[model samples]
Each structure stands twice: as structure tokens, then as C-alpha cells.
Target: MAAVTLICRPAGVLPKLSGTCSPVLLAAGPVTVQHRKIHHAVVPKGKGGRSSSSGVAATVFGGTGFLGRYVVNRLGRMGSQVVIPHRCDQYDLMYLRPMGDLGQIIFTEWDARDKESIKRAISHSNVVINLVGREWETSVAKAIVNAIKDPDANGKTYALVGPNRYLLHDLVEYIYALSHRPYLAYPLPRPLYHLIARFFEMNPFEPWTTRDKVDRFHTTDMKYPDLPGLEDLGIIPSSIEQKAIETLRRHRRYRYLDAEIGETKPAKTVSY
Candidate 1:
């Protein structure tokens, strides 16, 4: 994993503190500051198309989250019938409802951790996006396995989308063996915490920010033709490169290439 560094600077010079006790001294209280160092990864701009026009029905497992909302919006703009499975019909739906009226977003009650709920969600779509994960308990790999183990009346295609974490690789391989549908992983251009800090204008030097380093993976690297270990976990064959490219192009984020199973590396040696 790679780490992103950030520096913070006071918004203005600290005012000299005045006290009635002894010699005046600078105040040690909290001070307002702004980030000084600026570093960001480049993301390609999406190509213009018939913005509101997708012909496929797509289901999103974790469709009410931050990333899920973004994905749903993008898919809605693309005109795909977007189905989002939610655990509760609470305040979360308030934020998701507007997207639903775009003539594409649909909200349904389903639990990613429950196979029956997953099956019900899949029944209505030909393409599925599994975005479920645990903050601390269950592994994401298990969630994906449970979702794909069974398909609806119309056999569907699935693209597993989530953070480019290690646990997801196992799920990717498992999905490849089970359904042979392409897997999609979104790799943040920089560390996740840094992006969060930039979004919220937080001090990156805070102890909470020092947690974990983040890794970057290109979309082109996610297309594995064969199940690495389940069958033969290795680099995806050259034949699948085009498919990966098309998938990446559709998302307009990054390109997907071949990846070494259990490792994160740019597929420089693999010929496209």
C-alpha cells in the first residue's frame, strides 16, 4: 500500500497571547488552519454520449452509500434501469428518491448479507453490482459468494465494484469461476483518507488520519480471464483485454488490465 502525505498551515499568523499573570505568550488554544500541500491523482473526463440512455437493467446491492450514490447517478445518467437494495426504508431513501425519479433509479428492500434478499434483487436485472461490505465483521468476499451462488430467471451478468482491497480479490476470483462475468474494482487515485480529508477540509495530520496507507490499481488490471487459484490464478489472457477496456471506458474512471493474483502491480509486461 502507498501512503499520501498532507501538510497543514495556520490560516494566518498566530496572534500574541496576552495574560495577566506573567510575560505575554502565544496562545496554545486551537487555531484555524488550511491545507498547504496539494496533491491529487488525475482522472479522465467521461466522454460525451447520449447521456440519458442505457438499455440494460442494473441492480446495485449497496446503493445508498456515498460511492453507491455516485455509481447510481452515473448509471442513471446513462439511462440504465438502476435497482438499489437497501436494508431499511429510512432517511437514506430521502437522498436516493430524487435519483429514482430520473426515470432509472429504483429502491428496494434487500440485505446483502442475506442470500434470499440478494436473490430477490437479482431477479429483476440482467446486470448486478455487488457493493456490500462490512465495516468490521464479515469479509466482503463472503458477501459476493452468497450473491452470485444463485441467479434469477434470466441468467445475469455481474460486476463486483468496491474498494481495491485485498479481500475483494478473493471475491473477484470466486465470481470469475462461478459466473465468468467481469469484475470491476474502483481504485482511488490516492489514499482513501486523503480524499476524505480533501472533501471535508480536515487536518490530515490528526491522529485519525495516520491510520492506513492506500493502494492504487488500474481498471485495466482487473480483467482476469481465468480463475487464478480456483482454476489457475494468473494474469488474464490477451483475448479479454478488449472486454476490460470496454468496461473501463464505460465507467470512464480508469482502464482495466491484467493483474497478478494476490498482488497489485501495473500490467506493463502484458501485451494488450
Candidate 2:
């Protein structure tokens, strides 16, 4: 049996951190959320996180996404009652079923812009895990969870992040490395990249980010977050260099590349 865990959400002064990290400064109102700190434990695979007894009913917004899955999995293993509210179809949410005990996991159809729908879903639940902060989009889902579980960090916004900045080209290189395929970034002019993106954007089947995204990416600093991060919460963010290779291997398109993780081989069309 897993130990009972407590998660807290607080309302208080936000701490100062490095770099001018900006979000519409939210004035934290009186927060009533209270729970015990969840210490390290296993994330349930098929053996745990199951039960008929009701536990902490936690509502996870954006539960269908990558980070949401991580938080939900942990909560399931811990025997918390997880209520995942999603706008996606049933097929997408079905995978989360095994995370909790038989009746402990729940789902509600809801829309974010509709406050009532949002409120209704979490009304019966006490703890709420907000994973909607995607401005720093490519990172921080799991960090939101660690923040909610921290006590001293009670009520403060936890700005979790990767150790360094990564560009689109850099990520492509890492994916190729996972498959042991040699690859190179053929730098295209800024305007040219935007043109290609726009073409893809026009195709409904191949959506792409707007040019503004490219601008935000270019201006972003590779430095770490100045505020309380993974370290402050006792979590050492995994090494990006190493994790990238492993993570990419799971991708369907690159799964065929049979190189062991971190090992790379020459591309079929390579020059000695």
C-alpha cells in the first residue's frame, strides 16, 4: 500500500527570480487548498494506484498532454482520486484509466473559457493541478506538479524549466541521433523559414507555428529560470543531452533506427 499524500495550493507573495520572467502578474487570492507533502514513491504501472476507497480527489486540467500524464500517473500510484477534465475525445482520455484504482479515476468534459464548466469539474475535488501554462510551452508540466507538492513553496508560482535553451534545428539533430542517423541543420534565412512555415500553415493537414513563434524562439535565452526551480524542490532536472536520445527513440517515425540510446551511426547517405 502507498502512503497517503497531501498536496497544497497556496496564495501569497511571489518570490523574485533571475531574468525578467514576465507573466501577467497574478494577485493570489485567499487559497483554501491544503494537503500533505507527497514524498517520493513509485508511479503505478499495472500493480498499484488501484483501490475502491476514495482518496484525495485531484482535478488535473490539460491532463491529456505530456506533462499532465506524468502528474496523473504519480497521483494514481499514490492512490489519489484523479478527476481529469478534457475537451478531447474519449479515445484520448482512455489511456489514463490505468493510472488509478478501479473507481478512483474520473473524467469530466469541460471547456476552459467557460468558468462554470471549469468550476463544476473541480468543485467536488479539493486539490487542483494547473498545467495550462504553456507560454514556456516546451517545458515545465512536471514542474507544476512538484510545485504543488512543495510546502515552503506554498502558494508561490513555480517556474520549472529545462537546463538550457534548444532551437528547432537542435531538437531535430537529437531526434536523428536517437536513430543513429547522421543529420545536419541546413540554416535557411529567417524570411525563408517563415515562408515555409506559412505554406504548411495553409494546409489544414499540416499545421505549423506562425512566424511570431520563430521570433520568440530566437530571442529566448538559454539560461535557467531565476525563481524556485527543480533544484529548490529537490528535483534535479534530467540531463537534456542524455534524455533527448532516449525520448526520441520512442517516436514512431524514428523507432526503426536500431542504435542503442546515445549511440549514433552513419546515415545511409554519408561522406567519410
Candidate 3:
């Protein structure tokens, strides 16, 4: 006889669920039992509280920002309740509701400077994952996943990083191709870049490049960190060439109806 392994989604294969529901379970009959929360413990229908899923309850700060939607979606799909702290209007978050089952994605309004509110947000969580660092989205997510799953990761910290190295010029050219936009990445003096960043800082939502980022780029030699990275956590970091399109799809400047935004007609083939 051959053994079979079944995995239902993108988070990799999960262990077989145990019998006799405990994680919010409602029991009616042997075959009629179902769980309340999604993944943590088995909860039978009727015996358990009415909830969509469980396993981890994640409180994601900056959960409504860029990279946030992706993280929230991933968490929601994995049978976790993502507590999103938002200061934005409720309508802005409406699109994220469908990412998970009912009651699986919670929202709380938070002020960054409020210590008590920060404590309240994390009061029920067992894990703390910070995506606060600028441009820290894709890389950190992989590390957080491993740390959660690997017991060896307990008390250890990892710098979630991509494998590809890119200069500012390199990234700009990639984005130009990926977004199919005519933007140019011009190199500016370090001091001028800092000045521009400081000016833009006045507008909380305005886009600006920070001095820390510029400094880090230099410190990192315009690449991922020297420490063990995503590979250490069993995730192969994506190349900029690979990750650029999907990452910039929504920002594509031109779009023709009835077709995908990022993909234009294939480049013309010329045989010599």
C-alpha cells in the first residue's frame, strides 16, 4: 500500500487533524462533527463557538498599507485571524474582508504613539511579526513563516532578505520594464536625496526615499544582508526580475481592457 499526503493550499501540507474536537468544537454525531476555528484545534460544529478558523491569531501593524494586503491575505488563507490595526477609513479595508472566512479577519483602530492601544492589540496573540521596516514586506514574510513552524527558530532572529542584489539604477530599469512606464531612476547626490526625503516626510503618505534606506543600500552593498536569509528558513527568495511584475502590476500606467495589466504583447522576435 502507498501512503498519500494531501495539502489543500499555499501554506504547505499540514499535519492530520486529531480526533475528538477541542478547539471550539460542536459535537452532534461521530461523522457529523466539524470544527469551529479553522486550523489550531479541532472544534465540532454546535459544541464550539461560531468562528471561521484558528491556529494563530496575528495582529498585524500597518496591516492596511502596501505589503499589508498580501500578508493579511496569506494569514487569512491559513486559517488565522488577522487583527488589522487601521487608522484609515473603513471603506479602504472593505476589499480585504473577503480574503478570509467570517470572523477570521478582525480590525482595530490604532494610534502609533499610544502604548496602551499597542498592548491591547497584541493581548491575545502568541506570535509577534513586525513588518514595519521600510520595504520589508516580501522578505520578512518568509522568515516569519519558518520561525513559526521551526522549533529551532525559538528565541532566534533572522533578517528576511532576497537573494538578488540591485543598485538603485538596476531597480529603476527593472521597474521600467515591469511597469512598462517611461520613468527614469536618476542618481542624485546623497545630500540632495536626503533633503528631498526630509521634505516629503512632512506629508505622511507622500512617497519619498529615506536616508536610512540610502545608507542601508550602501552598507548592504546594494544587496540582501550578509546573514543567513530566506534560504535558511526554507524559502528561496525571489529575484527582482521574477518578483517585479506582480509586485508592480497595480501600478502599471497604461492598460487595455480585457487583458492583464502588467503583460503587454510579447516582445517582437527577430531571427538573424
Off by over 4 Å in 3: 1-52, 137-139, 177-185, 202-227, 242-272
lDDT: worst 10-residue window of model 1: 2-11
Ordered from best to worst TM-score, the candidate numbers read 2, 3, 1
Winning candidate number (lDDT) = 2
> Which tens-of-lDDT digit does each residue in 156-200 have in candidate 1?
222222223333345354435333345676556455646764554
Give candidate 1 regions above 4 Å deviation: 1-53, 100-103, 134-272
Where model 2 places Cα greater than 4 Å from the true spot, the runs are 1-55, 133-142, 175-179, 184-186, 195-226, 245-272
Worst ten in a row by lDDT for model 3: 1-10
Task: Between candidates 1 and 2, name the one with more favorable TM-score.
Answer: 2
User: Which lDDT tens digits does candidate 3 get at residues 114-224?
Assistant: 978876765554443444443454555545544554544433335554554445555556566666678655677878878887776677674566667666654432232
How displaced is residue 112 in candidate 3, in Å? 2.1
Residue 79 error for model 1, in Å? 1.0
Tens digits of per-residue lDDT, candidate 2, 109-195, equal 998789889777766554666554234333354454445445465445544555555555655666666655567666778888788
Highest-scoring model, TM-score: 2
